[model samples]
Target: MEKQELFKIGDVAKMFHISVGSLRHYEKFGLLKPEYTDQETGYRYYSTRQFECLNTIRYLRVLDMPLDQIAEFLRNRDVKKIQEMLQQQKKRVVMKQNELQIIEKKIENRLQQLQDTLSSELDTVRIIQTGPRRITWIRNKLRPKSYLDLETSIRQLEKQQENTVVFPGKVGIGITKERLLKKQYETYDIVFLVLDQEDNYNGIVEELPNETSVAIRFCGSHADAPVYYAKLANFILAHKLTITGFSKEITMIDYGITNDITKFVTEIQIPVAAI
Candidate 1:
């Protein structure tokens, strides 16, 4: 009989940079067994042919295949079974890819918004040309009067939807001309998230048309928005602009940048037409 080449467990572990414990685990799970064992010292050795089995195990593990499934597949080594498993994993990878892309877009927008807010002059109204946008929103007949109202309003929006957005920003508030004229600065009739035109939404969504608008970026809480709003109103009057749509109070720095509310950046935009 010819002597077959064999590898000690230590040699196999060092060669693969894998733990000997993992090889032992594979044995316990009936996935692979050592080709030879010395009874006197209870030492294990693997045949050179078993290296292919270990390679297959490592490959399946990297693909996140469950151990039990890997064991079953290895038992049969069926081409059709491997194809089906790979197909299922591919679907999961595709879903994760889409989710990552959405996250990347949000991060990019947040960075741009933070930079714009840092560079902007507070209390100065500016005219800008805006493209079309859409929003998924919560409308409240009674305006929000406190932070509790903001929380409650957001809860209402989430209550009706399959998924809720708590960290999404920039936050939007919509107020009618009547509300502003009545000095209802403490209350906002609607809160919204600006949505991508292609976003999947089944709830109340409003499409804002492309138009010229006046906007003011300022620092403070919602209670202090009237000051910036007044500045916008004055700018509109001085520039011969007419109010054309609801006012939107968007949180440029949606996350708190500092402990003080005065450090928070909020931007207010009102659609307008030249008189």
Candidate 2:
């Protein structure tokens, strides 16, 4: 009788430079099945043909494919099916890549702020008589994490605003009347949407009455916000403007979750009278 050629688990592991224990675990997980088991010693023997299968399994697993999916692919060995599954994985990876890119850009922005613009100018303030106009906005719970998730929400709000209101500006901005308060784990309610009140054409905004607001540009880290707020309070006092309604901040720039330091840029709005 001719002896059949076979490779022991250790030999295969050595060939692949993987530990024997890792191979045993993979077998236990149904990722690799031995060609035959010795009855007396209960030793597992793999066919040389299974080398490619093991390599493929490890590759797919590295791609973060679930164990069940990996088993299915190994069993079926269908190229088209594998390609389809890989395509779905690619999309998930791409979404993650976009998130990472946003984070990196934000880090760069913060670094620039830290080096050049954080505390050079004091008593820096601006006042603009924002004309009455129409805008479509979305109000929601906002916080540090919310900015990280801004793209999806911004896309949703933009679609909704375009569907519901006649907006002229090509830009989308978040506007709200909340007092930019920082409460740990507190729900931040702010509006995210399209603000185009200059154009006469309006579908939803035209329904509201005209009101005035005092606006200030805040270009600093979060620590600088209180100072800006104090300045806003001072501006109101100096101008003798009447405080009528809730003050708001229109988010023109967003540094989404690159880091958790003192870096945030927003346009602070204070509602005031013409006194």
Candidate 3:
């Protein structure tokens, strides 16, 4: 058959090393469309020229672009518009690269620290058995401009709780999935209360489950968490274990709680596969 002749879905699927189901899925998602359809046979056919278009859809989807937006862009197919979209994507990728670099650096530093700690006779690793505890905490939405406000708000909460004599656990922070995907820095909650306590501290109290593993106490600011994460990730990989959840940042020293980044000492906890 000549190159201009249309190929059936199965034919194109085989040629592209993709499953027929996948092709249908792309179509269903509005990411790809067959150039022609035989009403009688109910078969889908695509020209060879459509291969490039299909591949473009696949490539964009790999980058996590929404199919609706992809379809809109394809409909217009304006060179300038496509370039603008690509530039935006490029910015996102660059930001991700920067974050990865930061993570890599932290991991390197943590590895060295681990080696030093292990080798030093005076420095001993402790495996602490911690039970579930109830914590009273407040979750606040944090913006980049008001990042400093998070500490201030948390400190105020602590003071208010202390005055009211409410349940108190280690102050902890949580990151939402949305922030992670957008590369936006966010602090979802600053919770306080022990994990297995019966008393609810007048504030919002959350009961956290017990973590069974060695908890390393790192004395450092928020910036130190990244390094700790890197160390923890390395440790998990080295020991052939998987990190089961998002790591936790637990404040070990509050000194009556302050937002000063320099004085914050927190714990970065990661649940792992048992050795």
Model 3 poorest 10 in a row by lDDT: 162-171
- Please provide, for model 2 over 104-192, each residue's C-alpha lDDT reduced to its tens digit, 9 standing for 90 to 100: 76556446645443443434555546555445555565543334444554565555332333221122332233442221222335443
- Could you arrange the candidates by TM-score from highest to lowest? 1, 2, 3
Q: Which residue runs of candidate 2 sit more than 4 Å off their true CA positions?
A: 1-14, 17-22, 34-47, 98-232, 239-275
TM-score of each: 0.77, 0.43, 0.39
Which parts of model 1 are misplaced by more than 4 Å? 1-13, 19-50, 64-68, 141-149, 160-168, 254-262
How much is 8 displaced in model 1, in angstroms? 7.9
* Candidate 2 to native Cα RMSD, angstroms: 10.8
lDDT, candidate 1, 37-119, per-residue tens: 87888878888788899999989888888789899999899899999988987888898899888777767876886787789
User: Of the pair 1 and 3, which is ahead by TM-score?
Assistant: 1
Point out the worst 10-residue segment of candidate 1 by lDDT: 162-171
What Cα-based lDDT does every candidate model obtain?
A: 0.76, 0.58, 0.57
